[model samples]
Target: PPDDWREACLSNDLPEAGTLAVTLDEQVFCLYRVEGATYATADRCSHGRGSLSEGILEAHTIECPFHQGCFDIRTGAPTALPCNRPVKTYATREADGVVWLNTSPRDVAGQP
Candidate 1:
């Protein structure tokens, strides 16, 4: 395992093609599983500060429930109106039936 990778949840804990909210080191993260791949991003929407985990997940995008803003789950890029700022994204992977998250957040340029 990578030094920065910390266990977030068990693989079975996430529903297929769904989203889950997880807290690590007092920071909230939104976890998503789509097409057998997992992704992680800051749980809060940059624009409305809404919980992204409580929003709707569609393909590689998540729509903020509060203001209907959308963001690309992979890069945290805002994809719709009312959300011009990118949310933070974390590196994630699944191994040994567990989902691991890198505590360090990706840069605003979307580099991990």
Candidate 2:
């Protein structure tokens, strides 16, 4: 569960054309502040086990640094071929000047 969950950034902490990786609750979350609100997903690419934190973000998608795989930031669904596996994603919400991620108390692979 999210205990006393607090702020992640001041919205501008991450650029609109890039991403930011932050460790929260022992898990790595890759935050994409694209366009307006922020989006978050597990920092690992499910397909080749690539570190998504090291990938290049394209709009609402992330290109895996290891295998050039692409996944949607909003749903963590693989958008490119050779990487159909979906990564764990978290719910995002913005309050004040900060962004918050909700890592539900469920397995990432079995997330609803």
Candidate 3:
């Protein structure tokens, strides 16, 4: 059975408009708490495999630390230059002050 997902976060842990790095079953993803809901995406950037967890967040996108590539928080689409490759994104939501992620297998992760 899959994990409840929300168990990944403890009470009063997530920060508003902040990013959180989480590992689910060995898979690493950057969890972003935007507005109030939670969004998950691959922590590695499409350009040079940079650590996106350290990237900057603007509205609903994040800027890659390697080459300033921008990506959407919901779909993980390339939103800026220096990168055009799409990254994997997972389904996420928040409940009871904790964030939940659906780390299920993807056919072609991040694509609509």
Candidate 4:
């Protein structure tokens, strides 16, 4: 962790093309590893109460478990319907083999 960022998980903990659920200060987030890069977003689907961590990962998209909707893991944009709204996205980085999240909106580099 550094400054405003919080430690989420070890970089190695998330398998290749895998997703992991993490909670920080009561807020739930999903960590993803794809194509050798890591991404972070809210664990809950924007369209419903779907748990994204339990959802399927296809390329850069995460399919909502409840409604089968999909969202881009990197930008949090809804890529498939039944989900028109976007999930909150966070900036992520890997340091010392650990995944770190910049939960602050201002610090986040990704879009909603």
lDDT of 1 by residue, 4-103 (tens): 7889999999878789999998999999999999999999999976999999999999999999999999999999989999999998889999999998
Superposed by TM-score, candidate 2 places the C-alpha of residue 45 at a distance from the truth, in angstroms, of 0.8
Which candidate leads the pack in lDDT? 1
**lDDT of candidate 2 over 21-65, digit per residue (tens):** 888778788888777768788887888678887899878888998
- What's the candidate order when arranged by decreasing lDDT? 1, 4, 2, 3
Clashing pairs in 2: none
Which of the numbered candidates is closest to the native, going by highest TM-score? 1
Worst 10 residues of 1 by lDDT: 1-10
Where is the poorest 10-residue window by lDDT in model 4? 103-112
* Model 2, C-alpha of 50: deviation from truth (Å): 1.8
User: Cα lDDT of all candidates, in order?
Assistant: 0.92, 0.77, 0.76, 0.86
| TM-score, structure 3 vs. true | 0.83
List, in order, the clash count of every candidate structure: 0, 0, 0, 0
Task: List candidate 1 segments past 4 Å from native.
Answer: none
TM-score list, all predictions:
0.93, 0.82, 0.83, 0.90
- Tens digits of per-residue lDDT for model 3 on 1-112? 2564545564256677888788877877888877767778888887887888898988798998888989987777898998888778877766676667777533354542
Better of 3 and 4 by TM-score: 4
Residue 58, candidate 1: C-alpha displacement in angstroms = 0.6
| Residue range with the least summed lDDT across 10 consecutive positions in model 2 | 103-112
105: Cα error in model 3, Å:
5.6
Worst 10 residues of 3 by lDDT: 103-112
The list of candidate 2 runs beyond 4 A from truth reads 1-4, 105-112
Runs in model 3 deviating more than 4 A are: 1-6, 105-112
